[model samples]
Target: MTIKAGDALPQTTFMIPGDSGPEPRTAEALFKGRTVALFSVPGAFTPTCSARHLPGFIEQAGALKAAGVDLIACTAVNDAFVMGAWSRAAGAEGITMLADGNGDFVRALGLEMDGSKFGLGMRGKRFSMLVEDGVVKILNVEEPGAFEVSSADYLLGQL
Candidate 1:
């Protein structure tokens, strides 16, 4: 089932770009004791994701932190190298890039989307959630082809 408020996040491994190469980070390791503002895009560097979605989080990182968020993280079904490049290109200094390279995380959350029509394969839907101590406090999932609910500004308002 799709994860929702009050649900604990599924255990999964995400790749983060490390100095040497992609490094594995488990969901438990990342969220066990932290309040995290996490967002997911269909893919890294895609139009809406690149121009707006990811940037919104980057722009609101400080506000989110001030609102009791310990970390701001972005995830996509892309590899760590691509996520790292996108982060650097977008000047996302404070946002953590979590790479769901094989779609394990999203699949486990039941948030995977089919993007074959756009030449993209299985990908995560656009969504954001407030997770504290590995439990979801809020979840905002966007409609297909829509960007209204999952923006950082919207999430900030909810906070």
Candidate 2:
């Protein structure tokens, strides 16, 4: 089932390109004690994700932070290498790019969507959540091909 407002975020390992290489971090470690703005895209570098999803968060990182978001993070069903590259290419230094390489995290949250028809295989659905100190305070899950509720501006308005 999809995680909703008031659900504790599931603990799952997400890969991050560390200085030494890819590193494993549990969701609890990232969200605990922080007001996090976590957004997930179907895939990194895809047309909609590249052109809109990632850029919207990157462009409004400052505003998001000012609205009391301790950290802004972007997650995708891509590997660490791809996520790191996409972050760099998109000028997303202000946001934490997480690699959910195995689709474990999305599945754990029950947000996985079939993208096989598009040659993309399984992927995360477009969504965003406000997680405060490890618990979800708000969730905006978009319909297929929709971006309205999951946008940074819309989430910021919620805060």
Candidate 3:
């Protein structure tokens, strides 16, 4: 089942690239005692994700922080290198780009989707969540091939 509001975020390590090198970050460490906005895309550098979804979040990072969000993160099924490169290309300096390399976190939240037909293999669905102190406040998941619910504008409205 899809994770819902009031659910504590799953404890899973995400491989992320830092200034020094790749590192592991846990969901508990990310969400504990903070209000966070996390959005996930099916894959890195995909059409909608590159042109609209990820850019929107990058542009609105300031506003989100102004609204009291402690962290704004973008995740994808790609590895740390890909995610880091994409973040740099998108000029997403303020947003944290997390690499769900093995899909452990996505699968734990029941958000994994099959994309073998596209030759992309398994991936995370387009989704966003608002978490406060480790508990989810809102979960927005987009329909397949749809961009309505998980957009930054939509999640901003929810906040």
Highest lDDT, which number?
A: 1
Better of 1 and 3 by TM-score: 1
- Candidates, ranked, lDDT: 1, 2, 3
TM-score for predicted model 1 compared with the true structure: 0.98
Off by over 4 Å in 1: none
lDDT of model 1, residue 78: 98
Query: What's the lDDT for residue 131 in model 1?
Result: 96
Per-residue alpha-carbon lDDT of candidate 2 for residues 1-159, written as tens digits (9 for 90 to 100): 888899999999999977777899999899999999999999999998999888999889999999999999999999999999898899998889889999999999999999999999999999999999999999999999998999999999999
Indicate the residue-level lDDT of 95 in model 3.
Answer: 87
Report the error of model 3 at residue 50, Å: 0.3
Per-residue lDDT tens digits for candidate 3, residues 1-159, read 778898998899998888878899988888899999999999999999999999889888878888889999999999999999998888888888889999988998999999999999999999998989999899999889999899888888877
For candidate 3, give the lDDT: 0.90
Q: Which residue window of length 10 is worst by lDDT in model 2?
A: 16-25
Can you give the lDDT of residue 72 in candidate 3?
95
lDDT of 1 by residue, 1-159 (tens): 898899999998999988999999999999999999999999998999999999899889889999999999999999999999999999998999999999999999999999999999999999999999999999999999999999999999999
Clashes of 2: 0
- Each prediction's total of clashing residue pairs, residues at least 3 apart in sequence or on different chains, is 0, 0, 0
